[model samples]
Target chain A: MLRSWRWAAVAAGVAALVSLPTLAGALPTRSSDVTAEELRDLVRASGAVAHEAYGESRVDLPLPDVDALGDVPELLGSTTRTRTAWRTPLDWRVDRLTVAGETDVVRAGALTTTWDSADRSVTRLLGDLPVRLPRADDLTAPVLARRLVATPDTVLSRLPERRVAGRSAPGLRVAPADPAQTLVESVDVWVEPGSGLPLRVEVRADGQRNPVVTAVVLDLELGDPGARRTAFDPPPGSTETTTQAPDVAAEVDRLVPFLLPNVLAGDGRADPAGLGTGGVAVYDRGFEAYAVVPLDRDLGGDLLELAPPGGVFATPLVTVLVGRVERTAYVLVGTVPEQVLRDALTALRRDPPPFVGDR
Target chain B: MILTELAKLVRRPRTWVLVALLCALPTVVAVFVAVQEIAPRPGTGPAFLSAVLDSGTLFPAAALAIVLPLFLPVAVAVVAGESVAGEAQAGTLRYLLLRPVGRTRLLVAKLVSTLAFTLLSVSFVALTAYAVGVALFGSAEVSSVSGTEFSTADATVRIVLTVLYVGWSMLGVASVALFLSTLTDSPLVAALGAVGVLVASTLLVTLEAAAAVQPYLPTRYWLAFIDLYRDPVLTRDLLRGVGLQAVYIGVFLAAAWANFTTKDVTS
Candidate 1:
């Protein structure tokens, strides 16, 4: 009996060793009895959750070095590990975890505070702007689901259930009704069943076998993390500064910027508030979207110079184009195909969106 | 039996040599850093090297980071690989059995001694680096990776946690080497086998092609100790790292025990 016990222990040890990776994700698919519409509803309701999670967001776009955009290249090219605590959309904290340190961004109401550990500085900005560069939170499953699931022009279906972040999550696939309207082929998302928060999200570009962008919650726990976790206090000796920061640098006279048309390339302005400051305009069709922004001469000129021999930055997932109208450098960037950008640029040059900012 | 094993380990000249070597590396690194005030650029080199230049109180963490990748694990593998096989190779295993110590008890004692050696070596390195650091760079209140400066008390807590975490990580290596020691009569073969596992793990961890198995690899979370310095602290990877090491220790120790007890004592 003792000898048999030793053998039993050995068997159990091997079994445990073998199950580590299997438990991670390699197990057979879990059954899926839920419908696409139900999964979509669950995602929408995930916002009502008050929980915290640790996750990693990864975006791999092979774009050239247009370094002026400030971390744009890195955000689209590498992995970002994030620990997020959310009580509400208005109150949350996202700590970007790095190898040796962390940089924290805390939002309490309309105030956003950024604390940099390496530089020991604190910067406070009032108000959250709608038109800001994409951040780690933007790529997370919940946020991406919120954006991609709201479209009526996509055909939704239930995907096979699978283990995501150790949770048995049901999957949903959103495929565009018209593939030509956008570069996105499909988006697959897996959500936490209890709270309906997305555990993993993958964006697959047209004709691409692998996901162009993927975000996953590696670990998760539900329930309010308390106010202290979401709050921020400037450490003593930190160089603190507050600024009335504009969402985007409106370098040019707002009134002199071009007035974007109500519809361009068969897509209406994405922002319900309409175009602002002639500096930025977004157009969306279904789940497909693109943004046109006018940057300062130096930055725009650099983008123009970096444009490839064809003068258009093109990739499977993202495409960029720069056109000069007299001295203004207009940037056309989107997740749509390059042809859509070409048409937009031609329209801008010929029927040019009139400079209507002049009061 | 355990106390005897501990005494034997403590009395070994080779054990002291390993501890001294581990302690000496950080001293040399600290000297260069102190004199030249040059460290690898932030985020480019090892975890805490760049920050150590600004304040020396953090040198223990920096030292741990320097040895963790290779030096410390190699030292641990040698000691653990020798735990069983060295006895067999020296023709002492038969005598040890005749003394009537149960094979399971002997294995347990050896494991305990190996654990003691790891803690002692790691602690000596940290303590030496602390003295070297405070002497050369002064014990200025250290700034955390998150750009926050806490009291000296907080820094000490973090450094202590780092040492414990590092020692825990080394335990996984020792477990593997000990298991291999049960398989071979040659200490060199056992040590090399353990080192072989380490080399493969380290290589596959950095290779993108090995992404599927990377999470289960033994070396995956060796650096998660860095997470302790974060402002609110990210415990996700830290917990996972510790749990992974525990699984490794459990699986290998059980296998080692089962094999050693039943094997023929031909050596």
Candidate 2:
């Protein structure tokens, strides 16, 4: 009996090792059974739950697992990850740049403080929100699901069920309806069956088996993070800077020297791009989307230093290009290929602009 | 026996010539870059070469990048190929066996000497390139791909890590040549055979039809050393390269020992 038990243990060990990659969480309990419309409603409902909060919540956002050969679209400066833990409607703590660098941000009531560990300086802001535009990591299931479902020319389908964040959740596969508009093939999300909370998100480009991008909750426990209001206060020892967010139009006038002409939306209408709030130009074609942000003069030095001086700064999802035409620094951030960004920038450089000299 | 093997290896004029040739390639590249009127497009060459052209302090890493594919492996192949097979070709195998040197001891000595050559050659190239690069371009802070500046001390640690990772990667090439050296009596044939295997693996990796076999190829993960330049220092591929090299070393050295232990030395 002892010998049999040893053999069984060995078999179990081998089995576990063999299943390591596929065993990201619990195995699938059921096949995809919902229709496309039901899947849409389910995702929408999940998005709602993501917005609702009660107790303290802590979420860890890891960098997407990009393949070595770069088969997926990702973001620039994405080597860093973030952990956001918030106590509903009032107190919060967000640790950003945990992987690439060190930064700590805490928010209580109307006061938000950010501490940059690199220079050991603190910035205090009295604002309605924690940070500008709510960091991508802070945008939980509701925001992301709504954005994805609202995408034009998309094909949605139910996927095989899989356990996500230690709970069994039904999964959905979302892909571009028109394959020609984008290089991205599909995005799959696994959501909690009851709350609609996103448990995991995976993106597959072309036909690759391994995901090009993956953001999944590694662990989750819903309860109080245990912090007094004092935890949100900025440390007294560090130097402080009080600042307000910059004006959008003033930023656009300062940074954008020229704009790409004849830009069109996915619906085949001539919708020339314009600088939106925060000096960002959003471009969308069906399920394909990208954003171009004009950089602040102060931030250019560090961002440009790391990027290839005259070339594209690439991550798995996004490619960023910083270039100067007529001494104005322009940055293009997009989910598009490097070549596309390069071509856009090159075109802008060649076209002689009507000199709306100095705002 | 190990000391004697090392002495014998150092005594060979060809070994010195190979080291000089290995060290010279990067020196020439550095000089050319320093004198060029136009800078090569950034991100065009190896991971850090474009940056190295601007900041001479990073030249050692850039040199490793430029040489890793063909030059470094060729140097390692020649030395490893000659480890055992050169003795057989020169009619010295019989003489060496006539001594009380055990076969395992002899094999171990040869491998150790070859690995020692790899260490010296890689270091020589890195140091020479760095020196030439600094002379040509002024030193500056090391910038990571992830948009961060590293202090001199941090960058030095990374450069050291890069050198060691590249050295570790060459173990795969060295093992292949060592294994080939055992299979043949001609050092040239062994060296060429190893090179041929590497070339074949590189070619196979590019073909879409051969996708199934790419991961298993010895040449598949060599360039993964570039991932070291990233913040958080991408280690997945680096670890894979190191792990694969270890496997190759284990298998090839076992094969070499197994074949050498029972073989009759008639030369």
Best by DockQ: 1
The first chain of model 2 has a TM-score of 0.63
Interface RMSD of 2: 11.9
Q: Which digits, one per residue and each the tens of the lDDT, describe model 1 over residues A1-359?
A: 76678879899768877876667557765686888999999998787688888888888896676554455678788888888898998898887777786777888988988876665678888875646666667776777787778776899998888787777889999999998878889999998877889889899999888898898988787899999788777876568998654233333323335666767756787664343434577888786788877666687788788877766878888888888755778888888888888888777777666655443
Q: Report residue A83 deviation for candidate 1 (angstroms).
A: 1.1
Model 1 segments beyond 4 Å from truth?
A: A1-9, A20-42, A160-170, A192-195, A243-267, A271-278, A322-330, A351-359, B88-102, B140-151, B265-267
Highest-scoring model, lDDT? 1
Please report the candidate that would top TM-score against the real structure: 1
List pairs with backbone clashes in candidate 1: A117-B146, A117-B147, A255-A357
Q: Estimate the TM-score of every prediction.
A: 0.88, 0.57
